[model samples]
Structure formats: C-alpha cells, structure tokens
Target: MENNSKKIIHKGISASSGKFYGKCLKILSGEHLILQIHISEDEVHHEIEKFENTIYLTKQELESTIQKFSKELKKELVEILSSQILMLEDPIFLQNVKERIQKKLENAPLAVHNTIEEIAERLSSLGDGYLSERAVDIRDIGERIEANLVGKRSDYTFLENLKEEVILVAHVLTPSQIIHLDKNKVKAIATDTGGKTGHMAILAKNYNIPAVVGLIDITEKISEDEYIFIDADEGIIIQNPSLNEIKLFGASSKTDFGDSKFKPKKIAETRDGTRILVKANLESESDCDLALKYGADGIGLYRSESLFLEHPSNNPTEDEQFHAYKKIVEGMKNKPVIIRTFDLGADKFENEKEENPFLGKRGIRYCLQNKNWFKKQLRAILRASVYGELSLMLPMVTSIQEIIETKELLKESKDLLKSANVPYKRVKIGIMVETPAVAISPDVFTKECDFFSIGTNDLLQYTVAVDRNNSVISDLYNPYHISFFRLLVNTIQIAKKQNIPVGICGEIASDTNFTILLIGLGLREFSVSLPLVPKVKKIIQVIEISQAKKLAKEIMKLSEEEKYLEIESYLFNKHLLNNLV
Candidate 1:
C-alpha cells in the first residue's frame, strides 16, 4: 500500500455524476472459483443432481431478490434482474451444462463454469458494449450456481456487514450485485471495468449513487479502508488526499442539485431572461416524481417501453398502460407529458432479432408491424390524456406517410374509445427527428406533427453511419461533426420559421458542453435525465442568448476537429467549466 498521507489522484471515465469521500472496500472477482474439479463416471449423476438443484435455487434467489427490490430499486434495475432470472431458467443454458456434466463426466460446478466462459467469450467478441456487458451477467449467474453447489453464497456480504460508509472498488459488478448493495453504506463506486451503458452504471444513476467506472487496475492500486475522494462528475479518484484537498472535496460534495446555486425559479431562464423549458425524460412513475422534485417544467419524453419490457411473458393490457400513463400525467398536475410509443425491437425485445438491428424493424416500424399492440398503447394514451396534459410522440419516424398512418391509427383508437363510452381528451401528436431524412427536411413534418423532438443520439449514429456502441469506431461517432451541427441548425431553423414547438430529448441535451451551442441554434426546450435538470437549468440561467448565438455562429464555421477545441476554449474563457466539471 502507498502512503496514506500523500495526495494521489487517478482519472477515469465518469459513469455516474456526483462526489463522495469515504474509505475504499476492494471486492474480489469470481475468476478464482473457475478451478477444475474431477469426478468419476458414477459420480456424474450426483453432480448432475447437484447442478439441477443449484439452478433451481439460483432461480429462486433471483426471483426473491427481484420481488424484494422491485419497488426499492428503479424499474430498469428490476427488469435487468428479471432478465437474469430468465437466463437461469433458459433451456439452452441448462442443456449445455447438463451435457457437459453427463457426456464429459465432469463436476456440475466446473461444467457450469466452462459453459459460462464459452458464452461470455462469444458475447464479448461481438465488439458491442451493450452485448459485452451481458458477459458480466452470464458470469454472475454462473458464480451464483457454483456458490449454491458449494453451500456458500458469494453475495456482497461485506457491504451488508459494513458499519461505516465506504467507496466500493471492484473489477466489475453485475446488475444484481449492484442492486443488492446497501446504498446507506456504499457511498460511491469505482470499477476497473464496465462502460457508461453497463448495468452497474445504470443502477448507480438510477439510485443516485456517485460512480467512476473504466478505471483500469483501480482495485490493485487502492488499499482497503484507505480514505479517498471520488469526483464522479470529472471522473477523478483522489487517493490519500492532503487536508486542503479533502476540505475542497468536502465543500464540493456538499453542493448538489438541492443547493440554492442550482435551484431555479418556476421557469428556466438565462441571465438575459431567455426562457428555456427544461423538462425531464422519464421511464416510470417514480421518475416523474423525481423530475418534479428536481424542478422540471414538465415531462418531455415518457418512455412507454418499460411497461412492455417489464412483463416479458405478456404485453401490458390497455388498463395497465392507462393506469401507468395516468399516474405520471396526474402526478404532473397539468404539466405536459409527452408519451413516446414503445421504441421496441432494437436491443429491446429479445424475440425481435436482426442482422443489423439498428437499421432494422425498430421504433415506429416495430409498432406499425404489431398493429394490435400499437393500437392498445394508443388507446391507453388516449384514455389517460383526460387526466392531464398528455401528448403522443412516435419514435424513429422517417417519412410523412408514417405520420399519416399513425394519425389514422390514432383516429381508429379514439373512435373505439368513443363507441365504448370511454371518454378521452384530444391528445396532441408529435414525431421524433432521429434520422437524416427527417432532419434534412423538417418542413415535411412541421405541417403534420404538433412538435418535434430531436433524438440526437440516433441522429448522430445515422448521420455518421457509425455504430455508437462499437468501441472500435466510437471515435468516429462525434457529435461535433459539421454535418450533424448543420443538420441540427437547419432543423431548428425550420421549426422556428414554421412556428412549431421543438425540443431535444437525447444525450446531447444533458451535456453542458453543447448547451450553449444548442441554445444558439434556437432550441427553447431540453428534455434530459432527472439528475441533469438542475445542472442544465443552472447553465441556462448563466448564459446570455445573444452571446450564445455568437458562439454558435463561430462554432458553425469550424471544422469537425476544431469545434471541440473551440468549445473547450470558449467554455474556459466564459468560466462555465466549473459547472461542467
């Protein structure tokens, strides 16, 4: 271990944004449990029995955990655990383990371990971060099975037993392990593996836990119980910090979204008093409450996919969807709630697999193909609209014809509700500008749709023809590309000219670096994650709209490589770097 009195800082990628000061607790990986175990031919039957029992036990454990944590954790985390439970019960995985144990005369634990290794290797070799992260899930299940067979449960007992707060340092954490953590004791998390989209990362954000992931060899570098400071917003881990550094971090840690510095008036406005509607992009009812707590003007993007994904065995009924949508709409108390129809098929529904899923049947296209499911969702939205202000938005819409078809479906749904004497309010309809075709010709949509929400994440991916999840080509997925900026500017300009309400509900909307640029492009609405509402609000409250326009004009003239540097310099000169870091 290094000197505890010395100040040592390490930098890595920021997975969840926050600050924390606590002792480090290093967690060991399950790789050590992969040792070989030989068994005689006659013992193979016993081993198979043990394996089957262990599988059953693991499934029960996951189900119980899911039931226990379903309400306590975020909906997404619960769904992740549910998926793992399904994997444990998967026939293919079970058969493979059984075949290895019976044909090779191997011990159950070893057979399970080998099967997981093979599957994990194949998943990791796909070169997609989302799929690669599932490898962790496979290993987690394998470890659970092995632990059950050995009559020992290798859970986060250390976290459960902790008396004082600590920053968990580990090679990686599965979604279940992360959800099972006692947040009261685990103040923050630092992982040597995993990316921003990993299960652990999502859990950290959903639970409001500060985390810094992708810190290579973090477990090896930090000693147990050593006091450290984690600045998750900047992705910095300071080990053995000096007294002054500790004081600074402590002061900064105390400042959060709740601080008066970030709190805005009833409306979000710049220093020059340019009003910008800062709304929240939510997934569940809890998120709607969190958004209001964080001072969101309204719910901009209410992702309806969770309702379907949560119940993989069956689609949510019309009443289930109506109640779910009503809860958010009524909670907002007349605040605008834009409910986006299920953006399914692409990495969402396991049944809908494609060679190129990104460009295949997804979003609006998937909903259109499954017309009954689409109409059920529409009917629910229409029924819920009477409770409060609700708008229906379609995702991945590329053509005016798609909008026309969606309107026809809406009419049919409304007519059915009318015939049944189920009163429904007239809901406004909108479209997501996610592809180049929509962005290039915003005028076509302005006439048909009530509003436009730019999905920059998808738009960028489509514009550059790069897979954002592919690490090898991630650098090419640049948002500062001149083409993307021009498209964005053009779309915003068209919306403004047509007097159409336009907003951005993508990763870029939450980014402080692009906040000024977006404001300069005349975007008056920003729909971001719950935690980002206050930070973006603070940024909007500080910038002058006229200056932002000037900055945007200057940025528009730069080449792709120069834009990043220019923005960095501009932010530094304006002293807005503090808000970002």
Candidate 2:
C-alpha cells in the first residue's frame, strides 16, 4: 500500500464468489533445492538407480494422491497433474537425466534438475502465456523428483495452522494447496495463476471460500498480515481500505452471495404457471447440500469421471464405483440422478497418440474400446440404481452402434449380476446429444435411447469446430450462432415429436439470460450449476412462458450471421424484456 490513508482497489477474474475483509497471507512458491555438482564415477551408477526409484515412487505417489483425496476433488483435473506422469514416462526426459548421470558424471538430483529446467526453459521461450506456464508443471514434476532424490517428500502441511483469518495469496495455487488450506483461517484466496473453471476454483467454491485468480502479480503486491478486503464475486481487492469502504462492504457482503431471503421456493414456475424442472450439475456426493439448498429438482449431470479418476491406475473397482453412485443417488432423495459415464480425453486410455485428442476415441467411444471398464461401471450403476431413481447417461454418441454396444454390455452386466443372485434395478438409459451428427439427428437415437440431455458445451464446440480450451478463435464459439439455435431447435422438435424427455445439461444452461430463451425453445428441464439455480428460478417466476415462446420465435427468424447481436440487443433492452435482467 502507498500510504495509511490512501486506498487501492485492483480487479481480477472471480474464481470463487463471496466477500471478506482480512489480512492477506502471501504463500511463497516452493524453491528447488538441486545442487549442481559432478559426482565421482563410483557414485554415478548409484545416482542412476536412485533416479529410477524416484520416478517409480513419484508416479506411485501421484496415484496414491488420487486415491486418497476426496472424490469432490475433480478427477478430470488429473490431466493437469497427469502431464507430469507423462513427462516422467517420456523416454527423452528419463534418458536426458540418465545420460547426464552416466556420461557427464553429474549427481542424480543435479542431473534431473538441469534436464527438467532446460525443458522448462524451452517451454518458457514460447510467447504464449499459457504454454509459458507449462514451466510450472515442469518445475512441479522436477520438485517432486528432486524431493524424492533427496529422500524427502514435499507437502502443504505447513498451511494447516494460522493465528488469524487471511486472504491466502500464492504465485501458483495447486489443487493440493486448496485441499490443505484451513477454511476457518483462509477467508479468501488470490493467485497469480489459475482460471475461474480450474480445479482450485471449483474446490474453493465447494469450501465456500472467496477466491480471485489470474491477478498476475497479487503475491508480488502484498506481504504477510497486510489488511485487505476481497470481493470475489467481482474479483476485486481493496488495499488500505477506508472505514466507509469497510462499512459498505459489511452490508454488501450479506447479499453478495445467496443469503436467507435469496433461497428459491420449492417449486419454480413462470408467471403463467409454466413449471420448469430445475436441477444441478454435480461432481460428487459432497455437492448435495448446495443442490438441496437451491431446491434442485434432481442431479442433472452426475459426471462419473471422479470415481474413475480415483483409480487413476486403471478403473475404480466395481464396489468402489457402486458405493459412490449409491451415495449420490440416495443423496438426491429419489428425484433423479443422471450419471454420465467417464467422458474422458481419448488420449487417456489408449497407447495411440492423438494429434486431435478431443475428436478422437473419447467418452462413449473410449468406453466401447474398453468394455471391461465399461461393464464395471454399468454393473456398479445398476447395483446403485436400486438405491434411487438412477439413470445411466452415455457421452459422445455419434452413431447408433455405440448405443447398441452399450445396451449389450449393460445387459451382460445385469446377467452377471443375476447369475450371482445380486439384487439390482434396471436404470433408465440416456445419451448426451452433443455430436453435430446426432444433435440434428435425434430421430436416429430416439428409438435406442430413453432420454436426451443436450450437452450444449460440446454441441456448440463440435458444430462450430471451435476448441473451447484454445484461446485463439474461442471467440467464434458462440452459443447463439444461428446454426447452433437451428440445430438445438431441430433436436428439441424431433425429441418432443417422439415424446422423449430432453433437457439442457451443459455449461450454457447456467447463464440466467438464456433461461427465458431456453424456456422459449420448449426446454422446461434445466440442469445448471447449483449456485445459479436460485437465480434461474427467480427468472422463471417472473417471465411468462408465452413471452419466452415469442422471444424464441423471433430469434429463430433471424437467419443471417451475427444474429446473436440481435438476440442480445433484444434481451438487454429494458423496455423489451421488462425486468428480465
């Protein structure tokens, strides 16, 4: 801070939503402790053996961490940390270190450091900030190896104790750091690294800890015990705050997130009595409280990836997966639990390398290729189905053959269960209508699948050929693209014609602005982020479904490109929508 009297307010993107006034604790980055020294030829062989052991132990540790951590911790995020495992498995990385030890007679730790650091330095040469950040992953892997080489393992145990509450700031916040952070002590979180949808952010949200990320230099700007106020909803940080700012923040904090009155009524209905089925997208049983708090109709999309992530070595054992499914199904209180089976990257399971992993063997394709794992999950879900109204959903179904194979496998699973005299219930089968081929061809899947959940995120990405993860051309991945709406309208029309219950269960469904538009498009079932359900309910309670239909009718009429602008203008206009915002 510049002075005692002066106030400084900085803004970043909100990673988690809440408000808090506390002292900022700058969590410094871990330092690498590799010494550059050439070992005697006598010790070179020993160093080589030590290096090999470290790699095995580090990979084992990564697997153990996945098994130990709460299922609430995102399993998909393993891809981030799993990159380290890939690096370890990379022959070049291992060869570089070994050659350094053998040929250059360098110490194992020093050899590992030089090899990894050199690679990291190369990644740093790339101009892209995202790729440049790969240096951190390299360093993280190096640190793990370096620690193991020194016969010591690294951890975040030091963060468990705090004298007072603080806004925890870090140069690069890891998922492990988020897990070890004491919620009572850390009132908020700020990081120079991380995005809103990153694993750390999701964990922070689960803990209800206010967090802001992508600050670039927040750790550089603040020191330990510096009084600061964080408004994570806006991703704003106030330094050297005035008394008035504190007072204003005090009142604003109450309504900043959902307080008492903000809770939604049990049933959501439009002005003219158009009842909408409002549900939540959940990761694990841990999110049940928030879903219930927001009065969710059911668990819309229970991504089953977490359980598979738990057993990163292979697949979660059937019993392990069964317990998890049962808990979530029972947690939802028999409403409905739609579990989407392992929608993982194609590169995850196969020995084949994919230049374009997204479009390769993924989701249902991966399951079909690995039927043993698929059967394990099916049997588990079937066993848990008796616990509640459970539904099994398949991801990335471009053809009807995938569904047929799944049904055959599912029947096989039931037969095995029946042979063993194990009790189970037959669950409803659903397919994620995301592939462009199937999104507009609902008539094709109508006979095979029991229900449809339009995964707008993948649907939009595949239809427009935009990779949402790529920063470049991501702007072109518009949900309101005329063709997107056209495809969505057609999918819904065909499904409705066949009397199939369909709903939106993608990231696009979370936007409150789209609530009216979705309702207008004849989508009465909405499974959005749990926190946003209350807001969507409020929107539902105000807008007449009649007006929603009118808005949809007009949006469909705008056949030209940049039709999204016209739709946005329509929605944002105060006079047109009339308190719709």
Screening candidate 2 with a backbone cut-off below 3 angstroms (N, C-alpha, C), the clashing residue pairs are none
lDDT of 2 by residue, 359-421 (tens): 887899888998997899999999999988999899999999999999999999999999999
Candidate 1's displacement at residue 22, Å, is 13
Q: RMSD per prediction, one decimal?
A: 11.5, 13.5
Model 1 weakest lDDT span, ten residues long: 248-257
Local distance difference test, per candidate? Answer: 0.80, 0.78
In candidate 2, residue 300 scores what lDDT? 89
Sequence-dependent TM-score of model 2 = 0.62
Residue 238 lDDT (model 1):
83
Highest lDDT, which number? 1
Residue 194 of model 2, lDDT score: 66
Give me the runs in candidate 1 sitting further than 4 Å from their true place.
1-207, 210-262, 346-351, 560-563, 571-581
Off by over 4 Å in 2: 1-203, 206-263, 312-314, 559-563, 572-575, 579-581
